[model samples]
Target: MRSSSVLAIVVVLLVCLFKHGNSVPVEMETTTAMTTEFTATESSRKDIVFNSTEGEMEKPRYPHDGYCGHLEEACSDERRCCPDFECYHSEGRCIYLMQ
Candidate 1:
């Protein structure tokens, strides 16, 4: 009877250890996945400027006429404008104003 009780205790301890060990790896995997996703998102935010000698154009005048309204509008029209009116190339977006 004593031996049976000891065996049961050992089994329970092993089960607890296995559960805890499995959880640690799962948590680590989740954290790594989140970090990878964040890095991919950050890289995508960077603008890809195309420079070709034949079709390349000079930088437009700063302080575009108006707000870009949307990122696509600014990129498609090649207008350097930002929502905050800051005229500068930032992250992959254009800031329209000087300040």
Candidate 2:
């Protein structure tokens, strides 16, 4: 019937409006900040490429395993690594991502 068709159209319009209305603006702001920080960190890493020792460039040390190791689950949970790049600094080392 025509009533059922009109009801369906109203439901579709309501769903579309609700979907577009529910997003939080703060999330977009945070995402923008994260992107900016990432770009800066990448540029800084270029300096490490030239300044660090050959061994450091070849295989940076990790906090857990001494050489090129990933952070333990506990450490990662605590956000122990660097804010810009996840650094592993256990054995006098500062491990950062290449890019």
Candidate 3:
């Protein structure tokens, strides 16, 4: 019985992640010790936070063609993106603005 419940939790997690693009379970059964473990893990995951600092502040994006060096995919400053691409700080990804 306990093993089946654990397997169900694993199945639900994978189904939500791959088919629904969710990181957390939408609903859970509270009748088992495993539920408490899941709740603790989920709450702990949510408690984690990221804090940005100074000098490494995000900047605008710029344009550059291919060169001798390997181009970085992440955006941080003005030169990180192309002319049409803007650095979306909240999402931490480059977005095309000129389209």
Point to the candidate with the largest TM-score: 1
Index of the highest-lDDT prediction: 3
Once superposed on the true structure, which residue ranges of model 1 sit more than 4 Å away at CA? Answer: 26-99
Off by over 4 Å in 2: 24-99
Which residue pairs clash within candidate 1? Answer: 81-96, 82-95, 82-96, 85-97, 86-95, 86-97, 87-97
Model 2: per-residue Cα lDDT over 4-98, one tens digit each: 99999999999999888886454443343433344547644643343255544533334554333234322333334433445454543335556
Candidates in order, TM-scores: namely 0.26, 0.25, 0.24
TM-score of 3: 0.24
Write candidate 1's Cα lDDT for 1-99 as tens digits. Answer: 999999999999999999999888443433434333435354334322234766664333334553243333333345545334433343545444454
Q: Candidate 2, after superposition: displacement of residue 83 in Å?
A: 66
Global lDDT of each candidate: 0.50, 0.50, 0.52
Model 3 stretches with alpha carbons more than 4 Å out: 1-72
Q: What lDDT does candidate 3 reach at residue 73?
A: 44
Q: Which prediction has more favorable lDDT, 1 or 3?
A: 3
On lDDT, the stronger of 2 and 3 is 3
